[model samples]
Target: MPNGCDDQLPNRLARGGYSMRVRFQVQGLLLVLGILLSGIALAAKAPVLGEQLEYTLKFRGLVTGFVEMNIAKMTMAVEQEMGRVDENPAIVTDLHLTTEPYRKAEMIYPVRLHYRSWLDADKLHPLIAVKSLKTREEKEELLWFDHSQGEAYHYQSGELQAGSNSRPPKNLQGITALSDEQWENLLQAHQVSIGGIEALDYISFLHRLRSMPLKSGKQINFSTFNGKELNAYLVKVDQERLVRAGWNRPAFRVRMWEVDSESGRKGDDMVDLWLSDDNERLLLRFYAERAFGAMEGILETGRPTGGKDEGFSEATRSSLETYLGF
Candidate 1:
């Protein structure tokens, strides 16, 4: 439902490397957590809350030696209600991703999310849509454009005669057709970072942490409107053994720092992400180490051949099943 915390950032990252820095510090530490956990799971115990979830993203780096570049599997469903300020309010979240690579060929993206909270205009609106089907064939040659605030529209095939078409004729532009400041410097050198579903509340630790003095393995020092200054650390892994899928799942080790922002031209890379203390803190995996060789591929199966009417609604499926307690 967007509001994942706002600020929108994330496009994609991990490719080519050069800069490096890491520091650590720990003491006192008070608050920095963001809550968003649910409850209700007692069939055998171990499920405070859950509506519907599914994930499968395997990415092994190294183009020359360690292959496996793609494999995206996703299925999400969350709903909860009663919200003016709070009290368990989470609605709409139905994602279905199916990507493949390992060798080549495979793509499926079915996303539908809707969230609204006005409370008389307090502001909270998130609506994402990507569902087009007509038996494919590039869906008439493809043609959708949003670029962020163009609103939203996608075709990629044919049949979208508004005023006889003004600009929706790219066909299937690649490299995102560049030019948005060169696609935002190629999405900040692929370190990509677009609102991460709205930051999901920084990774919810039960919410309530905004002090900011820097503790728990401190390092801080941030900057990234393009100024680039990075250098952040703070670890606390252990959210139910981090669930698990592959690679054993248990890393968010945190404790990474790298600074160089006086205008030296180098700071488009920063990898260190792990957050899975269960309860749906979910992020659970991220590790990159590949400077230039680059050449990997992995993705075995994927479905959603056409697009199931692009779903969502029943009051956002009962508010994501009561904030994810499916």
Candidate 2:
């Protein structure tokens, strides 16, 4: 996310025509969102708390950033004005995303983000999501998702309130004249439907993708509510191949695109994902074509912090440690 929440880089903005500012946001979201890593075999049906997954983000083959995602069960006490207790089983995800320069330096990197998402443990629907980013300036975003009502609310705050001071469409400039796509985004902005398994953010979508039975040469379309706008993604399952990660084994190369994909259509600007084929199904490689170039990432480290081996193989666990040499 950019400091100027308005710099929606890859929000359907033409690829080659991206300004330097949009380029930064595109890289931020590409790395921040899909930096999500999950297993080939999810132990029970839901992720247990205290699970940590880390990935090394790269651009054009160079390590540029790192993303760490952690999950934990949170209990929210609904107090009566009289201080009564009402507990709920909720899971919260804390994500820390930062670039290489920030990691190696005392100063801040141009693109750095820290965000957390709280979801209903049983349903995997989000309750609240907050994100903070530091670029030319620092900005914070808050989103609340009401699945029952099928609506998501967004609030922006920061030292520099870039897009926060937006006026209604009638008073705002360029209301009558608009592109069809832009109009669609505007109309679906705040009001959205959560019917069935739709309205998922990319992080939630990644988790949901794991359970889906994606057979070879199959494609599935799903709706995603990206806080800023509503969009759809077409996920295509390509042939399987052996990709080297913690181990050299068979994996599925999945392609995803946010476009109007019709039958037998592969849309432009795709995101590529590789997941291990075995039951220990771990995320292996992630790649997405960005405005500047292709943004790439790989699983760097993963382990059950609870001193229990759910199913990760010895080779997979050991190989990750060797790859993270100091």
Best by TM-score: 2
My TM-score estimates for the predictions, one after another, are 0.21, 0.60
| Best candidate, lDDT | 2
Tally clashes: model 1.
47
**Model 2 shows how many backbone clashes?**
3
> What value of lDDT does candidate 2 attain over all alpha carbons?
0.49
Candidate 1, residues 189-264: lDDT per residue as tens digits? Answer: 1112323222111211112111111222433332221112122322322222222223233323332223453543
lDDT tens string, model 2, 155-252?
A: 55523243444322331113123344333333212435555655776556665666555556877777766666667777887646644334345577
Lowest lDDT sum, 10 consecutive residues, model 1, at: 22-31
Cα lDDT, all candidates: 0.26, 0.49
Checking candidate 2 for backbone clashes, the offending pairs are 39-281, 40-281, 40-282
TM-score of decoy 2: 0.60
